[model samples]
Target chain A: MKLKRTIRQVFAIAKTDFLGIVRNKTAIFFTLLFPLFFLIIIGFTFGTQGTGETSRIQVGTVNLDGNMIDVNGTVSQNSTIGDVFVQVLKDANFTVYEYDVYGDKDTNGTAAYDISRGEIKIAVVLPANFTETLSYQYTDSLGIPIPTRAHLDLYTDPSDPTGSIIGQQSLLGFISGFIKYYQEIAINQLPENLQDYAEVLADPITVSTSEADVSGRQLRWIDYMVPGTLGLVLLWSGLNHASVAIATERTKGTFQRMVIAPVSSITVLAGKFISSLAIVYISAVIMLASGLLLFQVNLYWNVPAIILAIFLGALSAIGIGLIISSIAKNEEAANSIAVLISVPLQFFIGAFFPLDIMPEPAQIFGEALPFTKLVYAMQDIMTKNLPFEAVMPEIIYLTISGLILFVVGIIAYRLSLKRL
Target chain B: MNLNDIEIDAVTKRFEDTVAVDNVSMKVAKGELFGLLGPNGAGKSTLTKMLCGMVNPTSGTIKVGGYNIRDNAMKVKELLGVVPQDIVLYDYMNARENLAFFGKLYGLSGGKLRDRIEELLKFTQLDEKAVKRHISTYSGGMKRRVNIAAALLHEPQVMLLDEPNAGLDPGNRLALWEIIQTLHKEGKTIVLTTHMMDEAEELSDQVAIMDKGKIIALGSPRQLIKKVKMENTITVVPNKITPKLMEAVKKISGVKRSYRAYDEEEKIETIKIITERAEDILPEVVSGISSVGSKILSVQLSRGTLEDVFILLTGRSLREEEQL
Candidate 1:
C-alpha cells in the first residue's frame, strides 16, 4: 500500500509538473532553440577553425599588363596579352585588379616615366630590346630570355606594401619558370653552329606526385559543434527546469501544498531532480537527432557509447542545475546564475574553441570542468575515432559530479524545508 | 485522562526571539469534536503544526492514540490528517485527481484510492464536475472543499482542521457541520480551531476559548452558556422621560447592565438583568413601568447563549474580535 501511494504521488507530481513545463513556452525555447542558435553561430564560425580547417582568406591580386609603343616611327615588336594575365590572377583567394603599365615608352609622346611609384609592383614592360634580347640569348637579372620575351619589371614597394615579399617572390618565380622554358625553346631554335656561353643541361629528373593531394575534401565545421551544441542543450534544459520547478511552483503555491502532503522533503527534491533529468535527456536526444539530421553531425565508433556519454553528461548537467536551484532564491536569480556558469564554461571547455590552441593552463582549467571532458569524449567519439576506453576518465568525472550534486541538492532542499 | 485520548501536555513554541505558543495544554477525548477558538495571532496554527509534526514544540509532549510524537514521528504523521488553514493544493489538477493523488500518498491504491476520491468528491458536491476540468477553474469555496478532500484521503484516526470555514458560505458552513458531525459519529478524534463562534458552537461537542496563547474557558456549549448569571434579559425603550426614567430603571431591582439599543436607534434601548426567572422579573418590571407613570413600552426575557458566554468570559463578542 505504501509503495502504491508513493507511485501515485510520483505520478501525480510528475503529471502536473510535466503539464506545467509544456505550458511554459520560454522553457521549451531555452531547452530547444537556444542551443540551435549557438550551434549555428559556433559551427560556421569557430567550429571550422577549431577542427583544423581554416576559413577562406580573401587575397587581393593586382595584375599589371604592359602594351607596346612606337618611338620615332619605330614600333616596338612587344605587346602583352592582358587576358592571359587575368586568368593567372584568378586563382584561389585571388581578387584580380588589372592595370596598364607604361615604362619603356619614355621617348614616345610620354612627358615623364616613373616606375618607382608604388602603384603597381612586378609590372610587365615590353621593352624596345624585348625581341632582340630574347633572340640573342641574353639574361636580364639572373634569367635567360627567349624571343618576344614578356619583359617583367619587379619592383618592391615600401608603403601600403604588406604583401610585397610574397608578391616579389611569386613574380620572380614566374619569371624564372618562363625564362627557363624559353631557354629550352630559344636555345634549340638557335643554330647548332653558334655556341652559347651558358650551357643548358636538360637531364634533370622530374619527380611527379599525385599521391597525397587530399586538400579537396575540406573538414566540415559541423563535426566539432554538434557535440558542444548538444551539451549546451542539456545544460539549458537541466538548469531551466531545475530552477523553475521551485519558483514557478512557489508562485503558484503548489510547492506549499506538496510540502503539506505526506511526501518527505527528500522525496520532493528527488521528484524534481528526476524531472530535471528527464527534461535534460529528452532535450538532448531531440537536439542530437535533429542536429544529426539537420547538420549531419559525425557519429562514428560506438555511437551507442557516445549516446551514453551524452546521457551521463546530462546527469552532471542536471546536477549543476540542482546546485543552481539550491543557491538561487527565485527564477530570475537562477537564470542569471545559470547563464553566468554555463556561458563562460562553454569558452573554457572547448565548446566555442578547441582546448589545444589555448595555453596549457587554460586547457588544464578546461579539462577540469565536466564539460571539457564531455566535449573531449564526444568529439573523440564522433570525430577523432577514439575508442570508449580512452573516455573512461570523463565518464568517471561526470558520474562523480552528478553524485555530489545530487547529495548537495538534497541537503540544500532539506535545509530550506527546515527553514520553512 | 484516557491514555488513548489526544493529550497536549504544556506545549510552548519559541520562534527566534518571540514565544508563539506559550505553555498551553488541553485534552481531547476519543470521539469528541473539540474546538480551539481564538482571535488572530492566538498560536492556533502553531499548536496544530506542532500536533501534525510539521513544526516541533519547544517544550511539550503530544500523544495521540497512545503514540508519543517525539518518539513516534512517522507513526504520528501516518495517523494524523491535517487540513491546513491556508488553501494548499496543486492548482493544475482537478478535484478528483487531487484527492486520489493525496489518497495514494497515504498508502491507498487500486480501487481503494478511486473509491475514496469518489466518496470525497460526492460528499463535497464536486462529483458533478469531476471530469477533465482543472482545479484552478474552481471557485474559492470549491477549492477550499478540495483542500479538505485532500486531507481526508488517508482517513486519519485523528483529524486536525484549522480555519476550515473561512472561505465557505453560510450554506456550505452548515454543510461542513454535517460532515464534522458524521466524522464524530464514526468516533474519529478531531481537533479543530476557528474564530467562527457559530461554527465552534454548532459542531464541537466541547469548546476551548483561548486568549493570548492560553485556554481561558473550556466546556460544552450549554455549560459555557449556563455560566452567565442572567436567564431573562430586559430591554428599556429609549424615550423622552429620559434622565428620570434612566434613574428610575436603575432604582428598579434585578437590572444589572444597561446600554443603548443594540441597534443605534434613537428611541430604543436595551438592559439586561440577572433574574432567577423571567416569570418573577417580568411582573416587577411591568409594575415599575405603570407605577412610574411611564407606560410599559416593551419587556421581554431572553435566554443566555454561547455568544453571551464569550462576552462574559472575554468581554467581547467573536465578531468584535474580528473587527479589531
Candidate 2:
C-alpha cells in the first residue's frame, strides 16, 4: 500500500511538473529551439570537406618504348609524308594521348596546348618515319649523344586562378625529378622534357580516404546533427531545469511549506531528481522520434542497450542539474551559475569539434568530461553499431560521477536547510 | 505546566552571535485561543517555529500534545498545522492540488487525500475557484486562504499562525478571525502571534504580551484589565491643571495613576485620572481646579480597555511598544 501510494504521488508530482514546463512556452523554446540553432551552426561549421569546387589537379603519365637517334643525331620518328595532322583530346592518366604526325605543313596553325584544366594538359605527336628511326639504337654514335624522344604538347584551361599557379610551379618539381634519370642526355637543369611535362601536369595531386568505422554509406548532415542535438538535450537539462524548479518554488513560498511537511529533505530531493529524469528522458524520446520521422536517422527498436545508455545519460545530466540547484539559493543565481559553468565545459568536451581535430592534450581533457564520453558512446551506438559493452568505460565513469555529485548535493541540501 | 497543553520551555535561539529568542517559556491549554502579542523582533515567530519543531531550540525543549519536539519532531509536525505569515504554498499548483500534496505528505493518500482536499477547499471558501485557476492567479487574500488550507490538510490538533492577518484588508481580516474562532470551537488549540493589540483583545481567550525576548504579562483580557485598579471605572481628562491642582487630584485616594495626555495637534495638555470610584473623586478634582484652561473636557469614563491596562502596567500605550 505504501509503495503504491508513493508511486501515485511521484507521478502526481511529475504530471504537474511536466504540465508546468510544457505550459511555459519560453522554457520549451529555450530548451528545444536553442539546441537546434546550435546543431545547425556547429554542424555546418565542421561538416564541409571536399564540398566546394576542386582547385588543384591530380596528373599521371606513362612512357612506352623509346627509340634511339640515327647517326646524324637527326634520326627520330620524323614527320610522315602526305598524311593528315588531326589533333584530338583524350583521357590522360599514365598513358599519354598520341597525335600521329603527317608531314608538318603549317602545323603551327593549330592551337598551342592549354596547361590549366585537362587531366594531362598535353599530348604526344608521333612521327610517321618512326619505322627507320629505331635502327640507330644498334650503335653508339661517337661522342654526339644518342637521343630517345617523344614530342608532346600540353593543353590547359589558362582561366582558373588556382590551376595557373600550380601550372607554373610544377615546372620546378619536374625539372628536379627528371634530372635524376634524364641527365644522361641533357647536362643542364632546364631540360625540354621537364618543361613539357610541367605544362601538361596541371592537376597537382590527391590522396582520398574512407573511414574504417562507418560502413555502407556516408552520414548526411542531419545524421551528424542528430547525435549533437541529443547531447544538447542532456547538456541543457543538466544546466537549467533543477534551478528553475527549485528556485520558482522558493519564490512562491512552496519550499518552506514543503520543508514544514512530514517529508524528509531526501524525499523532496528524490522527487525533484526523479522528476527531472523523467522530463529529460521524455525530451530525449521526443527528439529521437522526430529524428526517425523527420530526419530519418537510424533507429533500432530492438536495441534495448541503446535505450538504456540514453536513459543513464539523461539521468546523469539531471543529477548534475540537481547539484547545481542545491547550491543556488534563487532562480537568478541558479541560472547565472549554470550558464557560467556549462558553456565552457561543453566546448572543452568537443561537443563543437571532433576529437580527431584536437591536439593530444586537448583530446585527453575532452575524454575526462562526461559529455565527451556520452557523445562517444552515443556515436558508437548510432554510427559504429557497437553494443553496450563497448561504451562501458564511459558509462561506468559517468555513473560514478553522477553518484558522487548526487550524494554531495543531498548532503549540501541538508546543510543548507539546517542553516535556514 | 499542563501536559495536555502546548509548552515551549527555556527556548533560546542564537543566530551566529545574535540571540533572537532567549529562554522564552509559554504554555496554553487545549482549545485555547492564545495570542502571542509582541513587537516585530520579540522572537514570537521563532518561538512558534520551535513549537512546531521546525527549528531546534538551542538549550530548551518544546512539547506538543505531550510529545517532546526533540525526540518527536515528526510527531509534532503531524499534530501542528502551521499557517506561516509569508503565505507559503505551491503557486504552480492549483488550490486543490496544493492541498492534496500537503495532505499526502502526512500519509493521507488515495480517496482520503482527494476528499480532504475537497473538504479543505470548502472550509477555506476556495472551492468555487479550486479548478478555475492556479494559485499564482489568486489575490493575496485568496493565496493566504490556500496557505491555510494547505496547513489544515492533515487536520492537525494545533493551528500555529505567525501573523496570519498582517497584510489582509478589513473584510479578509474579519473572515480570517471567523475561521480562527470556528477552529478554536472545534477543540483545536489556536496560537497566533500578532502586533495588532485589538485583535488580541477581541479573539484571544488569553494574551501573552511579549517584549524584548520575554513575556511581560499573560492573562485573559478581562483578568489583565482587572490587574490594574480600573476594574469598573472611568477616566477624567481636564485641560490645563496647575501643579498644586495636580497634587490635589492625586490626593483624592480613589483616582489612580495621574498623567498628562499631551495633544500635539491642539498644543494643549490634559490630566487623565483612572479610578473605580471616579464619581466620588470627581467633586474633589473639580473644586481643586480654578483656571479657565483647567475646565473638565470630559468626565464620564465607563469601562477600561486593553490599551488602558497596557498603559497602566508598561507606562506606555500598546502603540508605543510597537515602535520597539
Candidate 3:
C-alpha cells in the first residue's frame, strides 16, 4: 500500500508537470521545432563539404614564377612548379585556389589576410627562377653528383594552425612525388643494362600504407555528428527544459506545496525525472526523424540501441538539471545556469567538431564528460552496428554517473526546501 | 491534550539567530473553529506551517489527529488540508484539472477522484462557468475559491487556512467567509490565522492572540473583550474646536475620562469620552456638547472589540502595528 501510494504521488506530479509543458504553445513549438532546426543547420553547414561526403580543408597557391620549363623540346605554357603542387592538393581532398601573378609584392600578406577573413586556409608562392634553378646540377670535387635544389616558398595563415600544418604536409608530399618521377624518367633514358643499376641508385626505399576503420563503410562527418546532435537534443530537452520547469514550480510555490504534502522528497525527484525523460524521449524521436529525412542518415537495425543511448543521455542531463534547479533562486537564474553548463559541455564533448582533431588536453577533457560517452556509445551501436559487448563500457559509465547525479539532486532539493 | 484534534506543545522554530515561533503552545478541540489573530511577523503563519507539516520546530511536538508530526509526518499530512496564503494552484490548469491533480496526490483516484473533484467544484461554487477556465484568467477571488477547493478534495479532517481572505475585496471576503462557515458547519476542525479582528470575532469559537512570537491572550472573542479593564469610548468630531465643548463632554455622568486632540491631516478636533456605559450616556453627552455651541460633525459610540483586547494587552493598536 505504501509503495502504491508513492507511485500514485509520483504519477500525479508528473502528469501535472507534463500537462503544464505540453499546454504551453511556446514550449510545444520549441520541442517540435528545435531538433529539426539543429539537424538542418549543423547537417548542411558542416556535413556536406568535400566531394559531398566529408568536410574539406582549403589551400591556395600563387605562381609568381614566370618559370616555364621546356620538356622534350615542347614549351610548357602556364604550367609552372606551382601548378603541380595545386594538382597534388586537389588529389589530397583539399579545395585548391590558384592566385594570379603579380609583380614584386608581399604575396604572403595577401594569403594571411584571406585566411583571417576565412576565405582560404593556406597559400604558397613560387619564385621566378624556380624551374631554371632546379634544372642545374652541381657536384663535389670528388666527382660525385650533387643534386640541385630550388626553393618553393610555402605560406600559411597563422590564425589557423591546423590548416597550416595540413597545407605544409601536402607540399612536402608533392615534392617527394616529384623527385620520384624525375628519377624514373632520367633512368628510363639510359641503356637497358645501366637503367636497372641507375634505378636502384635513384630510389632506395619506399613506404606502404594499411588502412583500417570501425566499419567497412567510410565514416562521414554526419555519422559522427548525428550522434553528437542527439546528445545536444538530450541536453536541450532534459537540461534546459527540466530546469526551467522545476524553477517555475519553485517560483509559483507549487514545489513547497508538494513538499508539505504527504509525498516524500524521493517521490518529487522521481516525478521530475520521469517528466524530463518523457520529454527527451519524444525529442529524441524527433531528432532521429529529422536525421533520416534531412541527412538521409542510416539507422539500420540499431533502433533499440539508439533508444537506450538516448534514455541514458537524457537521464544524466536531467539529473544535472535538477541539481541546477535546486540551487537557483528562480526560473531566470536556472535558465542562465543551464545554458552556461550545457553550451560548454557541447564544445568539450565534440558535439560540433571532431575530438581527435582537438588538442590532447581538450580530448582528455571531452572524454571525461558524459556526452562523449553517449556520442561514442551511439556511434558504436547506430553507425558501426556493434554488438552489446562493444558498447557496454559507455552504457555502464552513463548509468553510474546518472545515478550519482540523481542522488545529489535529491539531496540538494531537500536542502533547498529546508532553507525555505 | 491527547484528546485534542490538534496539540502544539512548546513549539519554537528559529532561523539562524531569530526566533520565528517562540515557545508557543495551544490545543484545538475537535470541530472547533480556532482563530490565530496577530499582526504580521507574530509567527502565526509559522505556527500554521508547523501544523501542516511544512516546517519543523526546533523544539517541542505537534500532534494532528492523534499522529505525531515528527514521526508519522505522512499520517499527519493525510489527516490535514492546508490552504496557503498564496494562491498555490497552477495557473495553466483549469479548476477541475487542478483539483483532480491535488486529489490524486492525496491518493484519491478513479471515479472517486472525479466525483470528489466535481463535489469540490460545486462546493466552491466554481462549477458554474469557471471550472473549465484556466486559473490565470480568473479573478483573484475565483482563484482563492479554487485554491480552497483543491485542499478540500481529499476530505481531510483538519483544515489550516493561513490568511484566507487576505487580498480579497469586501464582497469577495464575505463570499469566502460564507464558504468557510459552511465548512465549519460540516464539523471539520479549522485553524485559521488573520489580522482582521472582525473576522476572528465572527468565525472563531476560540481565539489565540499572538504578539512577538507569544500568545498574549487566549479565549472567545467576548471573553477576551471582557478581560480588558477599560470601558468603551464615545468619540465626537466637533465642527468647531474649543475647550468649552471638551469641558462640557467631560462633565457628563459616568464619563471617567475625556480628551480632545486636533488631527492635522483631517483638520478636525476629536473629543473622546470614556464612560462605563457609553451607549446609555450617548444622548446626554451629545446634548451637552451641542448646548456648548459646538456643532457635531461625527459621533461614534465604540464598544470593546477584539481590537480593543489586543490594544489593552499589548499596549498598542492593531492598526498601528499593521501599518508599521
Report the number of the highest-TM-score candidate. Answer: 3
What TM-score against the true fold does each predicted structure earn?
A: 0.68, 0.70, 0.83
Error of 2 at A411 (Å): 0.9
Candidate 1 wrongly placed segments (more than 4 Å): A1-16, A31-219, A246-262, A301-304, A307-315, A323-349, A354-368, B1-5, B127-130, B168-178, B225-324
The order by descending lDDT is 3, 1, 2
Across B1-324, the per-residue lDDT of candidate 1 in tens digits comes to 464568889999899888888888888888789988888877887788788777888998999778888888767778888887777776666777677767756667788788888788876776575545777787777777778778888888899988988877778777777777888899888888898777788888899887767777788877776766655555554333455655666566766543333423343545444454667656776666566677755566667655566666666655556667
Best by DockQ: 3
Off by over 4 Å in 3: A25-40, A49-59, A65-98, A101-116, A130-150, A162-204, A241-245, A299-301, A308-315, A354-364, B1-3, B124-130, B230-297
Query: What's the candidate order when arranged by decreasing DockQ?
Result: 3, 2, 1
lDDT of 3 at B199: 98
- Candidate 2 lDDT, A1-420, residue by residue in tens: 766656655665556666677777777776555565566565454333222212223332212223333435565533321111221111211233333221132443222322222444332333333323332332354643354443333334455544434443443344334433333333333466676555345324534565675534466545555665566767776446765666667655667677777766666776776777766666666666666666566533325765566566665666667667767777778777777766666766555567777789888887776667677777766766677787789789767766676677666667667644
| Second chain TM-score for model 2 | 0.80
The local distance difference test score of each candidate is 0.66, 0.65, 0.78
Q: Residue pairs in steric clash, candidate 1? A: A5-B104, A134-A146
**DockQ (Cα-based) for each candidate:** 0.25, 0.29, 0.66
Residue B156 of model 3: what lDDT? Answer: 84
Best by the lDDT measure: 3
Candidate 2 regions with alpha-carbon error over 4 angstroms: A1-9, A31-33, A40-208, A298-303, A314-316, A355-365, B1-3, B127-130, B228-324
